[model samples]
Target chain A: MTQRKYTKEKKVGEGTYAVVYLGKTEKSRQIAIKEIKTGLFKDGLDMSAIREVKYLQELRHENVIELIDVFSNDGNLNLVLEFLPADLEVLIKDQSIIFKPGDIKSWLLMTLRGIHHCHRNFIIHRDLKPNNLLISPDGYLKIADFGLARSLGNANEDLSSNVVTRWYRSPELLFGAKHYDTAVDIWSIGIIFAELMLRTPYLPGQDDINQLDVTFRALGTPTEANWPNVTALPLYNAINVYAPPSRQELRNRFSAATEKALDLLIAMTVLDPSKRCNSTQALMDDFFTESPPPTRPENLPSKNTNKKQKTE
Target chain B: MEKTSSLSISRPYYSPKELSYLHSKTIADSKKVIYNQRKHQVYQYLFQIIKVLKLPLKVLNTSMIYYQKFYLFNIFEEEFEDFSNIEKSMELDPFNVSLASLFLACKNEDCIKKLRDILLVANKIKDNQIEENFIELQRKIILGLEFKLLQILQFNFNNQISFSTDSLVLQFCKKINLNYKYSLFCWLVNFDLMLTPIGLTLPPHCIALAIIIISLNFKPNDLKTRELSSGVNENILDSLNPKDFKCPEKLVNEGILYILDFYIHQYNLSILNNYLPQINEDLNKEQIFKFMNLKSKFNNLRTLNEHSIDGNLLKQDESLSLFDYSISSKGTSRFINKRKRLLEEID
Candidate 1:
């Protein structure tokens, strides 16, 4: 056969910067190239575009998205990224995808390690969602999209979270905290974990207010009583009177979860930044330490449930 | 604009043709004044140490300019730096700034490169060389040379042709010179400052030529006009191959004028630092009066923000840790006084 060329692999999704194309590289390697249309700014691929390119270029870890190369021709900037066959959201939506104890544990561990790489480099992956977390065919997770990620030190000295999607967003960021460190990523991980296990968004809120409302209703409310010293956050005053979450309530909702998993969740979902379980510490948690090495995706611990199958 | 929220596409490394105009009609001619032998020794010693360091040629050119700017701020220093705050200004961000703001003309330009590798290449210089004492002196140098550097960078880039001569220099050598400051300047210009816009963001080659022309110590013929001397001429034109340039006549003249004028202007201008109290002060006053008449708009560079050394002092502490804690603190008052003197309002 003559050497094949890309025949419009489906437009998987559109992003703020580029229209993502699922294509194959010249070496016949399957890759995703994000073709960005620069606006009047003649801003060649944007800062975030270059940032993501640089960030991925430098960080070559098991859990992070590996950048192949960036393509720039004439005025257009194209980012040739690694092609991930499926993302966590796809797996989560696939009713056939079973959440065995080992499977869940492996994902959690992989996610933690991926996040750990970011924190070690003093980077904060501002946006972390299951969709952005692509799952390789072999089932390893790659944390993608670092357009907003930044190193800790800035000349301004303003530090507080400027991140978190409203739904999974931490309260600290909601108040417009100026200095955000790795804690913001940890908060997103907690939401991702909840999304994975619960099969639905743990807190599905529309806008910032809606997200806060969903979080409050699910976990009661956050106050200095629960999230100690939260009142001192850069934009802490923006939040209304805090109401502490009932630990009893989380225990009731996640009854299907294992003790270790719940413990990890609680550690990650700490109200205070100091109390949050960092990626390194979370990696050392009992979930991974006691696991049967997560049943290696090929041997999915063989779930045999027959009753009431979820319609895909 | 097709806004890419996932990516922070802020600004491009190159300047557009429209923005390449020099705001000032006439630049200062510092040719008559003589460079103080004391400061010139620093340049001579700066080269000596640069030779020892063995930096890449491209880096050498960029670094020379950075060394000059650093000297502009710390005019009295003759030695290398120990502390640095260049990074704090966000000038260290390789992803954001131009790879070209790094080098110099061929006689001055020792190297050439695409210059991307330099930004990511860190920790090449050993730590012992970066002492606290060294940083303090460097900080003074950066502070002293701030405006002098700005005039070279901002106003002079009114005309040009090439895209990135600085990066072209960096592509050639790891260390272009042995002078510690020159080596560091090469690294900063070709590698560091060229990588970030926070501290010193320079335009591309065309703009670079423009800036060099405008900052000329002697009266320069405007090259934007058809008949201009600041461009490539045929005598030098015959020696170089025409394969590289499409318009060799234009490029050669522009290129040669850039080199001849830049070093000549830069070297002659270096002498003027000693006579700040004489001809320069009068010219400076005249420039101030002329600039003051322009309506207070976006281009008014002499804002309160520019006047305050507090911000610059704080920014300088990041990479060029050359501030004397006692001096930087007490120096703020003196710095303000000095700043006022340099930026004195015309009565």
Candidate 2:
């Protein structure tokens, strides 16, 4: 009964598994159509596509990228998704733009809300990074790229540890803990928070082992005292001992952040996954309730010129 | 609690009376050997695919659902309009559609399988009349029609309250304090219903309830009969609290009558015993090609002749009545309309 007609304008983005095309419906609704490259995946409709279609169909929230429709044509599976203007990574990397700290709060709040909704529905957004967070024309952050999402694991079920990007992966995941929950996503949010404060990645490591090394270097090495049962993990025996950083050293790194904000960030980025602040706890922290409320999205500066330029 | 209620509402499972329309539709014309008599042959094909592929029971169940849902979009009337020469309608061949549904179900269930492997197994089980290349072509048609089939089915997968019947069985046993011996009987009724249109028609819980009620010999009336009336376990009933497991007497009776009718009328059909031979004798490559042509025409796929002048456009009817009424009538109009709109969009 529902009729839709769209014209393919041009290709927008291309990846190994899919190609995105810019399209406009009869109503002139701009849409992004992603066609899953067929005959490449030995399995028809790769698991990632299946996960995206399955979870997106169930989850309908404001901060989540909407999957408009799905259809197969010419033996290729195509997903019709909301066309987002830009991604958070683009904003973070744009040195020409000076972002207010309030803007960072707004983005992180929206991200947490989106991930919270997914967690409530028993889904884990296994992959979360700045690149996967898109900004709409309204400047609202929307979570995109649900390819690695999955339902929460049942009791005694072992999920793959090779999920979330290595740079943003949690300590428990790095230690090869197969049974993990939503704390993995909270850790990524912590890294994003740190990146926003510093205007660069906090711990950008080359590989899984190096990623652990960098994590320990930044946050003290985990021992039985700090993280109970720390060595029982499958890959924990391989972890090299690194001396703990002093409180002053940690304070000096993120000096730009308020003390409360820093405390929340530390809670999120804790070495112990069980002790990490979850989405709800993180949102309810004093840092968010204290002075300098998240910026009103519209009034937030899209791009700011530095005072040096004005003086010149 | 609100989520549970909404989940139930979304699936929209029907009663036997509501699904009886599908039964009549499957019966097709009352004139010749009723298609109802031959309908059971499709289940045999599904069973063959399950056995050959060693698919899980869930995959087989989903495949039957797909097969039943497929016919709702594709009726026998449109398929047999050009069946003047052929004795049996190849357009609705259960074997091919069952194989296709099974293949699609594999993907749906995350049990990935190669198209070639499935085709080989299907060919070996049935008569090898289909050439290997033709089988490949069949695979293409199946995959091509996947989206349309999904749209027609209204994406009903993942909508059910999974294992609701299993819980019901456990609850019933705990209530009566009787170790459940009715599981096998329940499975028998459920699987048999898959072959029939009953699965598409009735809620799984209602079916399970009907089986339990009959096997337990519980009184249909007396709403107050929630307490154990059976003398076998009065002490057990007294020791345990029984959850109210109630169904409308009408639904239980209808379920019983439906299964009874199937047993009396269709139980002795030849296809039930030897469907492989029937599939072999009924299906051939030429018939398949002819059926494909008919289907493509129905879908309004523009074809090229020796002169390549768009064969489909030429089939446009002379009368407005035929053009609008004939094509637009029946439940299949949803598929036709969507396919037309999608084709335009793609172009």
Q: What is the C-alpha lDDT of each candidate?
A: 0.47, 0.62
| Regions more than 4 Å wrong, model 2 | A25-29, A35-47, A69-78, A153-161, A171-180, A216-237, A242-249, A270-275, A303-312, B1-18, B26-60, B75-96, B109-142, B145-148, B154-157, B160-347
Candidate 2 chain B has its poorest 10 consecutive residues by lDDT at B1-10
lDDT by residue (tens digit), candidate 2, A196-253: 8888889999988899899998987899999999889898976678877776787899
Which regions of candidate 1 fall more than 4 Å away from where they truly are? A1-13, A39-44, A159-162, A225-229, A234-247, A291-293, A298-312, B1-347
- Number of the top DockQ candidate: 2
Colliding residue pairs in candidate 2: none
**Candidate 1 lDDT tens digits, A1-312:** 111233336577676677787777566777776766655332122445645754665577978887654433333455567777666776677777678777877777788889898888767788888777776655667888877665564323454344556677886777667755688788889888888788888888888766766766665456777767666765555444435456666667887777788888878877666678899889898877775566575553222321111010
Q: What is the C-alpha RMSD of each candidate to the true structure, in Å?
A: 24.0, 14.0
TM-scores, each model vs. reference: 0.48, 0.65
List the lowest-lDDT window of 10 residues for candidate 1 chain A.
A303-312
The CAPRI classification for model 1 reads as: incorrect
Best by TM-score: 2
Candidate 2 Cα deviation (angstroms), residue B145: 5.1
lDDT of 2 by residue, B219-324 (tens): 1222122244433443542343213455554555555556545544553442322211212222333222322333333343222122432334323412101112
